[model samples]
Target chain A: MATTVESPGIRREWQRFTPRQRLIRYAFYLVAVAALIQSINSVDIIPEFLEDAPAQIVDLFARMWPVDWAYYPKTVHAALIETLHIATLGTVLALIMAVPVALMVATNITRWPALRLLGKFILVSSRSVNSLVWALLFVAVFGPGGLAGTLAIAFRSVGFVGKLLAEALEEAHKGPVEALTATGAPWLSLMLKAYWPQVQPSFWSIALFRWDINIRESAVLGLVGAGGIGMALDDALNLLYWDQVALTLLTIFSVVIAAEIIVTYIRSKII
Target chain B: MSTAASQPVAATRQNPFPVNWGARLGWVALVAYSFYAASLFELTWERFVVGLDNGAKFIGRMLPPLLGKWDLLSKGLLESLEISIIATVIGVAVAMPIGLLAARNLMPAWVTWPTRGLIAMCRSFHPVIVAILFVKAVGFGALAGIMALIVASIGFIAKLFAEAIEEISLKQVEAVRATGAGFGNVLIMAVQPQVLARFIGFSTYQLDSNLRNSTMVGIVGGGGIGSTLFTAFQRFDYDFVLTILICIISMIMIGEIVSGWVRKAFQ
Candidate 1:
């Protein structure tokens, strides 16, 4: 005769049906409703705000029309170049700085535990703040320009690339690395012969992806006085030159599309 | 595998990295150019030393973040929370269809190309830049900020979603299709299960990011605590700035904890 015993899955189901699960579920539902209620109150959409809002909307659109198309050629070239410069330099430098740091950070790659902890700390601190915050800090310290913008992008890229590369490194197959080591290859040779090949495709794609993000970010660094297309756009807005604003938007939109095409083509080649 | 002494460096470099003088020179030039670029940027110790005092002063001002205007800050914070939630919910909801259409493996080139292009254009902008555009288009307010972030949310989540769809186990999808199931049915039965966790994960991440961004967008007059923070900065209310920073940091950390809890519950 078998003793009365519940299977693990049945035991789990029984636990879910217990009073504790029911209480937790109910509590969760209550909190969600409360949050939704809070949102409704905060927006203050009780008809008064909506009434005046429509007129403002109409006025805004009227002002937006008849955009100054002529402003495009003058503004696009210089600002676009600066933005590209910042992004390209940032990505290249980041790739350079990231490799050794990633190797050091990865638990499997870096045998020494202490060094790994230090690398992780470095990555966390660098990544903790957003790039805009970094731009703000650098702007205050170094006076605002493309240099500050580049630094902000580069520092953030380091954190991003290092963390991602380390994870990829950790997930790489160990057999090849061990084989190279067993054959008395030097550490550098082991990396070049074994590890890099496996991770290169992913690394290239991530780098290109970051480059696209950095370009967009670089454009906006000017808001903090860090310099780029953003500065010109900021000037246009402040002056209430709606036409110029429209022109700027069109330029940025077109350039961004072009960039996306380039990145897609490059990614296809690499992948 | 020869002895280290017997093996020629030429053999190792031959296939992948040609040992031509041109390649070696290219490597040398790259290293030299990098160092040259660094120096041109004026990243000097002297400048850093001079800035320390100013930095200290700035930090000092940010102290005891004055919560004197508690009502204003609390109200703004609430609005920000709403904007983030609404944007995440709507954006993620819309991304489902668009992402489905854009995945190359799932859709034909005609459908994928245009959808992909739209996502790319959306992705190509920072929320702040997008906010500025929306402000110009729709006028400055919470609405502009909301619209901007919604576009941002779509740009990111949909692309990741499309990639996720592309990476799904086609075997399962094919099996469902083999059962004479329509596209929608195959997606529901096979694709959704594989990608549900990632979609949830992306949405949570987007929400967290949106919360942080919601604050910044207000600096450009997009509405939320950022507007208040900008005012404080402009008024030279350094202490208030400090207070706002503390509040923002706490808010984000709380968001992280809450999102983590949500994920845990769902899983």
Candidate 2:
């Protein structure tokens, strides 16, 4: 047995981070600070406008007060309905399109690496381009309308739904799959009997979640002439109709909250 | 015994696959609604076929992407990058204290309630809408874009950060308190360590989103590549539009890589 050292002879202390970690952290901070300084320097901010911001905000809000409640029944109602239609229809379209992509992406379902990569490429391209960008493109090709908005929402949502659905598919339990395979079930039968039941709850949940997001997205697609409430908002803004703008904003806020509530309630029941 | 067993089997022999009535009804309603909505939009198959024809031509035109306007493209890209970085930095910095105050586990109900309300209001509006307001207020440019993105980052990061803080182990805080540490000390030592990695993760995610948004905010005159893109679209410069899209996608992919690296490094 070795003898223990005397306590007074040795120095003991505590260190929160190693030298390497501390260096790395300091370097990160340095880069961030540098980037911030450079960005601030490059951004063209007029001193006058910066100073006048508070006054400008106060003036804007002053114009927005006493919202145009009467404007709702006149124009906003139809636009609001259109927005909901676009959201729901687009979500359904996306669900239909995403299922195949999700199947291609899921490793457990599609054993080929090349197909999975292709699936990933589709998803990434769809997601990287913002919904508004997609709307802009669709509007150009389709001559602008709710059709364009619906297509944009569907295209944008495919990536999100496909990604999540693929993950859920991958996480399906192997026991049922093996059992079905041992019973000489075909691929389609295996998928339906083994994987579908396991992922059904998550599939519905993901659909609801995407629908909630689609509502907010479709509400703004009209700014690009794709159709919906944003068209009214765009019109009001151009006309300098602050009251109407305010009313539209309020309508959108309420719709978003309502969608959130509905989704949450449905998800709780289903999941 | 055999007769009794047979009777039990007969009684138990119900439908092997019972149908869900509610689900059936839901499907029917969904289908009916789809038809009605499609009719309202006039989204007929003929329209789709014509649009598909246009789309094919559009894709054909986009094949030879115009790379001639490097200067204009670079300028817009730089502006977008600047807006994203500035917005992300300011947003994350401002969100820190707000997130701390909004954490129900750390703060009183009164503090959390108001802070959470503010966060909700922030999150309710789309960034483009907020950008329009900022453009009007600030008279358009990168500043408006930056401000809009900052608001977005704050809304997203603060709520997530607050949730993270709330989920942290309270025992660490108790231990720090038992050591006669001040509130600030306790927060720095006990709270910061636990949440720092997650905070970094959230900030990086916000940065990625901010970058994506910055490119589009210019369409509303918020000063970025979006205005240029909108102009190109209006001018029917399909090739240039394709180039811009490609650039945006590549930049986003790069940002994803960088953010993933940062997350790994921090972890």
Candidate 3:
């Protein structure tokens, strides 16, 4: 505790945190540390591998030093293009699918509580499972192609886009909606005229953001034969073609950077 | 009625809905590209119908999901939980210093630049890709999954931490410094108080994300329920796959609820 003297006879004391809060904080820290210790104990780490990790990393890097640039024109290029297409198409598809879901989820838009719960459940299911897992499911049904990759990306993004879009719709200005209602506007017209404009900026922003994520995701979908650069990377990895692996990794990196820049630029311009 | 009134009405009747050529062109380009991409992928109506039919059968097979492989499923699930916990702990510990160094407000430009670049590189790849690399380096196990998730946690939480630090009120920092306090003391007294809540929030969020990712790293043999799920998929064990998926989703949902409670408590 720190104390300040107001007078010689009367001193005031100050404390940073209340005793209860301090206790809570300490308990949280204790739990975290205990969890960490328990997990570390349970996760088996072979000591020899741990000891040689540095050497192994160095050896791996050495093998990847001279990347096979020749692999690009042969296979990597087509895969990269397919990845971009999947991301773009998937984003568009997700936006289309998410609009109805968003409407259902937005409490102000959808009056039914059960529907809202159902919409939330749909969103959660979409989001909880990783896109890779969705890709696995779609790949099974669609038989391992760009279509499966696209569907996975679309399904995953439906949750993200729908959640944000619903929030935006919920926060729409009430005045316009009231005015629309006074004029006896139909539900469709009310949604279009009042809610659409209010959420347009955020909708585009969400779309672009999800599109950027989809690019990175689609790039890796090929690992499960869902079609994209990931398939090429998977092939190289399996063959232990370090140079090709390095090249594929570099391509994925550059593409990710490019997508980020493009999304940022578009978002600034649009929103 | 009057000629002057009629003239004013005619002048006021200008077009209210002006077309934006730029937006129209963008939409056009998007639609065109979508068409081209669909054709490229042979995504015709027939293909979609066929997919739907296949999906119907798939769902039918997945119904009443099998939970008979409790031993295997539990093992994988436990391994994923352990991986996420260890990764989050190590990653957050490692990220703190990196985040401090990367904060432009707190560090020199030289220190911030390379550190920011490293964060960007860490963020560039998906965690699975990183897991693949780690699997190659570490000879495939929970170690590789843990390392992959550690990288992801650092990339995510460190960037947000650095940003949060940058947004701190410098006035508090200056006042602390004016008291002749050392750098460490100033950070503890001024910076930590401002960012601790947010740091905790980011950490919990990262833990949730790491948990989600840990389940998937096993796809690349880094170790988790994902390898088992993948194997199940290959064997056409659709019911088992559904069981695994339900378990994963429920686990994540529970994690989300717990993290939400933690965040509220801290706040």
What is the DockQ score of candidate 3, to 2 decimals?
Answer: 0.75
Clashing pairs in 3: none
Off by over 4 Å in 1: A1-34, A44-69, A96-100, A111-115, A175-201, B1-75, B103-113, B136-140, B165-194, B235-240, B264-267
Tens digit of per-residue lDDT, candidate 1, span B1-267: 565458777455546544669757967886776666556556567866766777777777777678688998887887788878777777888888999999988899999999988998788778998888666555567777787899999999999999999998899988999999998899899999899778877888898988888887887877788888767766878787767767876788789899897676655
Candidate 2 lDDT (Cα, whole model)?
0.92
RMSD of 1: 5.5
RMSD of each: 5.5, 3.2, 2.4
> What would you estimate as the lDDT of candidate 1?
0.79
Deviation from native of the Cα of residue A80 in model 1, angstroms? 2.1
**Per-residue CA lDDT of candidate 2, range A89-170, in tens?**
9999999999999999999989999999999999888899899999999998898899999999999999999999999999
- Pitting candidate 1 against candidate 3, the one with the higher TM-score is 3
Residue B87 shift from truth in candidate 1, angstroms: 1.2
TM-score for candidate 2, please give it: 0.95
Candidate maximizing DockQ: 3
| Better DockQ candidate (1, 2) | 2
CAPRI band for model 1: acceptable
DockQ of each: 0.31, 0.74, 0.75
